[model samples]
Target chain A: MTAKKIHPGAPGLLFLALFLLLSLPISLRAGEALVSGQYLSAVGQDIKMQITVAGPAPGTLIVIQNLPIGTVIDTASPAFNQYDAGKGEVKWLLTHVSPGRYIVNLRLLSPLAPGGISGEIRYKNPANGRLINLPVRP
Target chain B: MDSEKPLAGGIPMVNIDGARIRRIREEKGLTQLYVATVVGVTTDTISRWENRRYPNIKKENALKLAEALEIQLADIIDHGPPTTPPTEAPSLLSGEPSKQEAPEPQPAGQEQAIPLEATAPPTAIRANHRLASRPVVLFGAFLLLTLSCLALFWWSTANDGENQVAAVRTLPAHATPGITFPVVIEVTTTSSRSFSLILKETLPPDCIPAQGKPQFVSQASDPPILKWIGKITGEHTVYCYLAKLRPEAKMDTVHQFTGGVTVRSDDNPSIPVSGTDSLQVSPFHWADSNSDGRIDDEELLSVYETYGGIEGLHFGKKLIEEIWASKGYRFNPETRSYEILQ
Candidate 1:
């Protein structure tokens, strides 16, 4: 078959669209992307935790973390999350997050086991208008 | 015969005729010295009576002389002397210095007034006057009254603090052994003031405290000597303690415990108030819910439930190890009972 030269414009548009889709979450969540956690006591033995979030509106965060088996998350500042003691999973509903950093304090009791306390913070990215996940370990 | 009559003073007496005294003595052939020795008088006095130098002799002496002479008392005495006026004889009213010898003339106007000695008698008169004066009697009475008032004041003040009261109270004046009892001590102030307070209860030697040791109101334990120290005010202060009677308490005897409190006020340091109270302990069996004097698993569970589980479990498992276990108590699973081991 005889080759016909076609302009590469359509491919560029496709690449741009893919780029926009990939970068959508970052743009929508523009103001800031920050989350941090720290143990309120000197040793990690203490069950008190303080979590801070900065910028944009990270509305309704779902935090999934493993706690010592026997521990029950008894109390939290800004109020409590839906927590499952057996699964060591906790979910928080955060709204109207300010542009700067703010803290949420948490307390648990009777920590029976010791292991990595890892969690993914899921929030609605304001830039892409879609839910996004950020990983954290404190 | 007249010598036998009573004298003018109505004393039973015999009048001795002085004139017959010498005649009788000479007739007896008794020497005056011998008569004087028997009569317990000087020989000079005997001679004066026999010679009539003394017109009258005492009736007692007359009787003694007559007895010595072996004659009647009337033989030695003058019968006329007892009836004679004493003023006409040797009268002291005559104002003569030697009035013992005979009467003398006195000034005419001295009938009502007494004759005053120039110097010697004034001292006696002044002393007599001072004793009867109204001023001296009044002064003595006033001094006695003042001393009485001062003593009354001292007595009231000395006992004022004692009358102010602090008190102690114990719940269930009598308690059963192996059970805990509440003890309270109260203090009331004499005056409105801030003060330091201390409450103490001395447990009987056989008893143990549920809390391990007595916790003082503010201070440390003196043990067997339980005590407390703190500050207080005008209101009454109360202190509390929980103690357990020994499980092995004897049924026949009662254990005595004493409690006391002392209060020292800042304003009134000199006066401190203290009070004391007592409690008694008798035999009791634990884990015996039905009062059967024995323990079964059902009874143990019943007791645990009654004691409010862990919070009220003063004599729990730890206490079993320390106190009750050695007394032959063991848990039997098959029987489901806590029994006294054979």
Candidate 2:
């Protein structure tokens, strides 16, 4: 049998395709997810909040960063999976979560000012390692 | 006569004596109704004239009044002096001159002299007589009526327990078992009276006060009476308890909470008012549909169906969601299960 005609650029074309596929942004491939945070009440000297997450967020890292001054996580209530007190960040790492909604309640103790305080929450996509920030209004 | 009073119709004004009419009518033994009939007017007109409520009357009516009194017109009129001949007055009334009188010619620019009051209608004279006597009496009558109304108001309000003290109680009409809700009591008083006020809220059997040792003197009595004893001067409000309804409370049945408030002032004691409010425990627990104290996927689906299949249930749909959240159950629509994350 005669040998099949060899295309010289076939291997090069295959390598270029592989490079493009690997370099594609993970966020472009993943479904969009949302994160919302609210400061609920002042319990004695402690502050309370209810945070919500909507969409399929499996293997995601949820971070609440840049908290208002003089505030820290309260041990009396539910504890976060990971927290960096120096960075003012509270992190929750979810593994093997299904496509659904989730909510978390956190109580923080702070020497709050007279009027009110504000903060933000960030959602880290495990696939592309992208951070989405959600503001927490007064 | 007060010059401030309006003048009678004449070059020289006069004040009519209302008492003279009463005296003359009495002397003639004439009833006001009879006189009014003769004058073609209501008895009230005659009464008003005698009372001096109307300062003036028409001269025609006055003449009729004199005839009804069986008196001459001049006798009824209190003219101080006649500047003109009385014969002229009669001539004016008869609308004719005396037959014996002859016309006299006067010098050029010399006019026949006649008093304007004599030529003017008696109606004009009556309108000019303008003082309303007995204003003091009218003012006294009005004052008496006003005082009577104020007394009546005071008596009615005091008798109805409105003038002294009033109290009201309010509570949520419906609540889920083991939920915490507010109970409010308000007391008001019209007078700033210093008194010892006691507010007693009788909670249901399984209810408990969420807060301890409130600002007021608090006490717990059997049948769960939460009592506050303090001295109040005017108005006060007592938000006694954020009461947590026990899970053991009877489901689907309304439970009544009664409240009694009493005020003892320096003048009055034992002013007590009582009111009642009720709360019904929801028939089914939201997350624990089977009362298993945990949310199963089936129960979650049932909740979704009941809430119109909307996710992130809110507004009218937040009742069950709030209860479940209170129990530390975060719903996962993907797996359709509620997980307790610490």
Candidate 3:
């Protein structure tokens, strides 16, 4: 059997094709993207999460989920997102939680783009106000 | 494209493509703030332009904003004819228009000028003002009426005449044949008026006023007194008159006093002749008939015929003692008589 000669330009062309293919779905979804999940734990501790995402629209909705076993939420706290009629985003504050690790998953309802969605959830020592990042479970 | 000139007498207009301007801004991802800053104005000004407020953004600022936002000036200003049809003008010569008649459209170019004169006369506008002035006038008239009434009342009370008459009172006279007891009188007057006191004595045939006239005593510090005496036992009325010197004022009045008394004489001469000069003592002896120590009918008749008559009698003390001693009686002062000694 004789080996066929590989053309240099052909490799570059294949890579370009893969790049366009990956970017096509993101470009088509030019609407708002929302990512959200919750934190869970046992008693006598707290969990905190910092969320950030970018999209073509001015606002995005994010929801944090899976609170700890003895966790309480404070709805009246100052952790609120400024709402603009032209853009839509909703922020919520989950507080007075217990100790434990949790897996927080995110979803985008009207995603503007791909690879811009990311968030971090932490197990915080409520007494000391320290942060510890929690790992996502498979 | 060349800008089209507006027709004479027609209001200037600007065409706006709101959707296109919004799309361009979105495509550039520029906020309204960024555009307003580039145009040297506020975000609100830009919003006003986009919203198409009447008499939209000043011509100069609008042009500047359009250049900065990179959009055609026409895209921010609406220039088409009004959506509603223009109202018909009113005819001044016509009779007052019915309520249904369309109100006159405001002068086209001067829409903002307020036609104060055409709306209503200033007086009509101030009808409420006339009503407001009435209370002041009414209050003033009420004050004047109250003052006049007070003045009339004061004048009437000030002119009332003073009291000039006096009060008169009477008292009793001495206890005599013709006299009464408690002889006194009081007279009170508010003015300086003179009074007269009169005392008249009416006597019986056998008697006369003791001194030909009644005595009069006047005291400036006390009431006056009038005294009279008579010899016979009969009733007599004494009268007094008080008259004010001011004849024009009816203040004269009269008063009267009255009393009565009796007197007797001692005489005895009449008698009948007896056969042996036994004195014809008829054995039916007269009891105190003489009102003297001895019983004598002739004396009794003589006294009755003399000093009018004795009202009653006070028998002589010596005769009462002699009678009681012969009867073996003792005198008892409490009974005013003699009783037989036990």
lDDT tens digits by residue: candidate 3, B154-227: 65543321222222223211111211111212223232323221221222121122221123322111122222
The better-scoring model by TM-score among 1 and 2 is 2
- The better-scoring model by TM-score among 2 and 3 is 2
Residue by residue across A1-138, what tens digits does model 1's lDDT show?
999887789889999999999899877656355555554432243444455766554443444455655566656665644455666665554434445544444566543334446555655554554545566555
lDDT by candidate, in order shown: 0.52, 0.53, 0.34
lDDT of 1 by residue, B109-149 (tens): 88877555444577777786687666878988898899899
lDDT of 2 by residue, A1-138 (tens): 898986999999999988788766554445354555666653335556566665544234343434454456666344564454555555443323445544445555555553454455555543444556567664
Put down candidate 2 lDDT per residue, B14-56, tens digits, no spaces: 2234457878988765567656645657766676566543424
lDDT of 2 at B187: 71
Q: Ranking by DockQ, best first?
A: 2, 1, 3
Q: Is candidate 1 or candidate 3 better by TM-score?
A: 1
C-alpha positional error of residue A71 in candidate 3 after TM-score superposition, expressed in Å: 94
Write down the TM-score of every candidate: 0.25, 0.28, 0.15
User: lDDT score, residue B271, model 3?
Assistant: 15
Query: Residue B151 lDDT in model 3?
Result: 88
Scoring the B chain of model 1 against the true B chain gives a TM-score of 0.33
User: Which one wins by lDDT: 2 or 3?
Assistant: 2
